[model samples]
Target: PVEIGGGDVGVGCDERGCNLVDHHRVGGLERVRAAVASVLDVEVTAATLLTPERWKSLAGSVGSVPVNLAGELVAASGDGTSVVRFPAGTAQVAASDVVDFFSFPGEVGGAGRIDRQRDWWKSWMSAVGSGKPDTNLPALDLDVIHLLGTVAGGRVRVPVGPWTGGEDVPTIDQGRLVDLVVAMFPVPIPQAPGLRPTVRLLNGTGDRSVDSAARQAVLRAGVELVVVGNYRSAGVIQTRVLHRDPADQPAAAALAAALGGGVLHDEFLSPVTDLTVVIGSDFRMDGQ
Candidate 1:
């Protein structure tokens, strides 16, 4: 049980003492999955740091354009996966909704404004108020559930919360958190089918922090960190995840997702390693 407690959120101090607000952290679900996958020796097929930007980029990469309905973005891929996103509670909740949608993408009985100006639940309500949504027009956006459908290979209902959050977070229940995260995977993630992917981490940024962060993410993916060193050659302005064989593609994709998506390629430097992650200066612990 992940005992939730402590000064995880900030109690901003001032002349009027500390103002306690319900502060929460968005994203990091992929990292949670990675940590659990590593500990449990399970291999997840796909992972992505789903954000508006990521959704847009993924749509573009898959060669599709998302229609902006007021503020919500919607796109249907050739693979039959439709991507919808709108600003809302936190990343996990929205994602869960998406997973639900994929299980049953209800037809748009009515359309609502998807304006970027107003995003929160209240604003969403006001925008679709009265005859629009005074009763229950429709849930505008939620792609996380759709993603879960993709991950689970079926429909599922999962709840997200501000478990252990904030910068001063060190005493968090890692084991329990991992348990919760593992549960989020389809069924309980099973043990790896074969040996975990072998990974080579190259620190192109020469920043120890970058190296350390990359190392952690790579390890969290349940891969073999076979080699770690500095990238000797130049021109690596951005992080890149490369794989030598088609088989390692999933592992490479998982690593890239853990690192918040980066340049990916098939370098084909085979017989040495399955995947290579070159840490560039652009990489950040915060997916900025």
Candidate 2:
């Protein structure tokens, strides 16, 4: 929980949008909130389903402080001073460090109520399959975790006391921090038994012969190679695996895992293959 002190911070909205106000003027907290919220959303329904025992366990593990912002608890903080505990670390913030806090709507992060319901059911089924109580679940909301990091000032570089040392303190990488938060929410990908989907390799990185090297690695992993070609966009940076059917997601996920790391997309353009693997500049055959 970040302990906020100093600075008069409040929430306000206008023609532009919601913003953080400090002594009747705009401040940095709104920008910080938007920057973090743009990439994440806290699903309140999923959070609500967590039993008090489960919440306690998750808080102990991740150091999250789940509080209702609309309740009297926030009012008790007194004049924009509050403590917000996030997963990354604890911080002392001023009123200028915080904007208004609110709950996400039923539709957030392109996921609606139905999608959340389906996810909840899937989570329940997974727990039942593993013969574990629902209380043992990991925190499933990435947005909430990211917000915690944001409030904890995980994205920005701040002075760590007086530094009279040899090496300068490294700036925190927001991308890596988000990735760490993502790693906390583990979802079970279903794989089809005895199914080896054909892979169409595309070189998106424009690197010389990188696709050829990747092909060898894929072949070593026993993934079937249907074709090798150049991707439409040469500027693509991250390696990705696209599957034609939802049922083949596990195959795509397996192929991605075997190849080190890759984002999975639900779009297959190839007529002959069930999966399309694009090799980007970030990809290394050695998994570096």
User: In candidate 2, what residue range of length 10 has the lowest lDDT sum?
Assistant: 161-170
Candidate 2 ranges beyond 4 A from true positions: 1-195
Error of 1 at 131 (Å): 76
Superposing every Cα of model 1 onto the true structure, what RMSD results?
20.4
Model 1 stretches with alpha carbons more than 4 Å out:
1-194
Among all windows of 10 consecutive residues in model 1, the one with the lowest summed lDDT is 15-24
Q: For residue 146, give model 2's deviation from the true position in Å.
A: 61
Give the clashing residue pairs of candidate 2, or none: 1-84, 1-85, 2-84, 2-85, 4-93, 5-93, 5-94
What lDDT, from 0 to 1, does candidate 1 have? 0.47
Q: Evaluate residue 121 in candidate 1 and report its C-alpha lDDT on the 0 to 100 scale.
A: 29
